[model samples]
Target: MKLLDSGFRRNDNKLFFLTFYDIASPKTGGNMAGKKKGRKISGKKAGLSPGSLVYVGSRTDEPVRISIMDYDADRIDEIPEATLDDIKKCMARDSVTWVNVSGIHDTAIVEAVGRLYHLHPLALEDIVNTRHRAKLDDYENHLFLVLKMVIQEPETIRIVFEHVCLVIGPDYLISFQEREGDVFGPVRERLRKTKGRIRKSGPDYLGYALMDMIVDHYYEVLDQLGEEIEAIQEEALSNPTAKMRRAIHDARRQVVVLRKTIWPLREIVAGLLRGESKLFQDGTMIFLQDVYDHVVQVIDTVETYRDLLTGAMETYMSSVSNKMNETMKVLTIMATLFIPLTFLAGVYGMNFKYMPELEWRYAYPSFWGIVLVVFLAMLLWFKNKNWL
Candidate 1:
């Protein structure tokens, strides 16, 4: 595996390089390439040293890799795998260049890129450690951005999170990704076809395009979530069982998590729009404004889903109450039907010496007739009351 270096002359006439690597090579030594050389410490001594480097991005057994795409309005070049020195030579030219860095787990390669680009240590740290919230940082010479890219796994609704770090300078844009695959295929196609304003624009426009792609994923996710919410609503209305209630609750929690994920994203995009960084040009700001609108739409959709889930919960409760009331009505009707019969049985069961009905043979039949009349009358009364 080779590192790409795009050499650009700084104001001091010093050469700065851009490095690219092909991570699939076994000769690259993978994670062991930059193993720290130091004595192992334990307990208090371990605490004395800086904490162990945490690898928060992609994990791959293959070597690190990089690719460079240098272009302008009339010229374009694609270097599949360029060495660091080769990239440096290209960067010295007047054309706009895009360096794509894939596989950031190797500390040596990451540090080398930082040094070449004169990136701040904290910025390099943020790039190497990927568990960062989405943000935009403006340095004097360039802008650094950290964003999460989400992709839906085929045949499944699950989302995979990938961190993409961007460095936007005057004439170049650097994209750092944890893994190899990306959604920028369309952008590359546009660049190749000279379609739209991409080729005519600068690095800022490129950055906008990439961000727009990322925001589009949010729409896809929101659509799926909306469909799920609708389905849950329908199920709740049709069959209000314990299982349905649990499902509604689970759906509500998922919506809450979705809201949490998307809420801050709006702010991040909004900050980019308002930021004074030269990395975003006037034309690009217009594009970012559109992106901000999309973000707002996403946030609105999430809130709507939350409200629907809440309404479903209420519907479930009402259904349960109605069920309980119906059960009580049936029980009351049964009690009413047995009342007169119970009284008649109690009267006949008594052994009173002066009881006229117990003395004669005809009395037994007549007593049953009287009990039948009482039961019929009570049934009619219940029917009139609409309790049966």
Candidate 2:
């Protein structure tokens, strides 16, 4: 991993190390940054000047990987790991140049790329922060886009998001990701096989394809959440437990996060469709419209899921309350039935010497008969009142 010597003094390096150490520390609930379970706080840059290139995210040991894909209608050149010279060569050509940087922990790569492409310092800063939500910033020569690549953990409804930034220029598109994996495999495949209009399109179209894939993956996440809701619903009705209640809450949280991440995307795509930025071409507007529609659908689905989970949570609470009420009713009825029996026993146990009951042998039996009659009358009354 190449380090940015100029960007980090010795003290700055220590500060960076201490910040990441805090992120990796095992302390629990020291002071929650937010409600997120394992999110890294962006407070590392709190006191820093604007456009400082501090990596405020999960750290990694893997070396930075830069891949290049330069293509046009005739042919394509693919570089698995591109050097600076290779990037420059690709950028000089008339073909569409795509430079994909897989890791951003090393500020050198970001700095070098920024110098090469004349990217704004603020844009580069946001690229490494990893906590910014989806947004768009149009510069004089390029359009900067921040998007989240979301994935649900296996066999669980937990959603993980990776920050991605795309800089779309006239002939080149530079992408920066927090990690190496992405949903751009299909787009890569299309470019390789010359399958469609992608090879003939500009970098904006490529950006659209990448964004579209991310949006499409939201459908899969929604499907998983939908299944989780159904299971929670069934369990809630049958037997609501504390664990099940927690599951409902967790699912609701996931939906909320998904909604917040995806909601702003609609506005971003709509802005592109409205020709707010000249980076997007007229030909790309239709495709951006499609993406906008998909965003709308995803937002609608998220809303529906949010409402469903809320309803599920309500149903779980209601079921629990009903069970409690039922138990209390049964206990109340039993207590009511014992009230008269206790009263008669108390009345007969008095130690008065001239008590009339002590003079008769049948006093005890008469008392027992009176108790049975009272109990039976109360029981009958309860049955008639439908309170049994």
- TM per candidate comes to 0.78, 0.84
* Candidate 1 positional error at 253, Å: 2.6
lDDT score at residue 97, model 2, on the 0-100 scale: 95
The residue-by-residue lDDT of candidate 1 on 238-319, one tens digit each, is 6688867766766666666556656667777778788677667787888889988988888888788889989988988888
Q: Which portions of model 1 show Cα errors greater than 4 Å?
A: 1-53, 57-63, 346-379
Model 2: lDDT to the true structure: 0.77
Give the 10-residue window scoring lowest on summed lDDT in candidate 1: 23-32
The residue ranges of model 2 lying beyond 4 angstroms of the native Cα positions read 1-43, 155-157
lDDT of 2 by residue, 1-388 (tens): 1110111001211211101111212211221111112335356777889999999777566678899999999999999989999998887798999999988889989999999999999999999987778898889799999988765444322345668899999999999987766768878889999747999999999999999998987897677667667777777787888877766766666667778889878878877887978788999999888999999999898898888878888898999999999999999999988998998888888888989878998998899899899989999998999987
List the global CA lDDT of all models.
0.69, 0.77
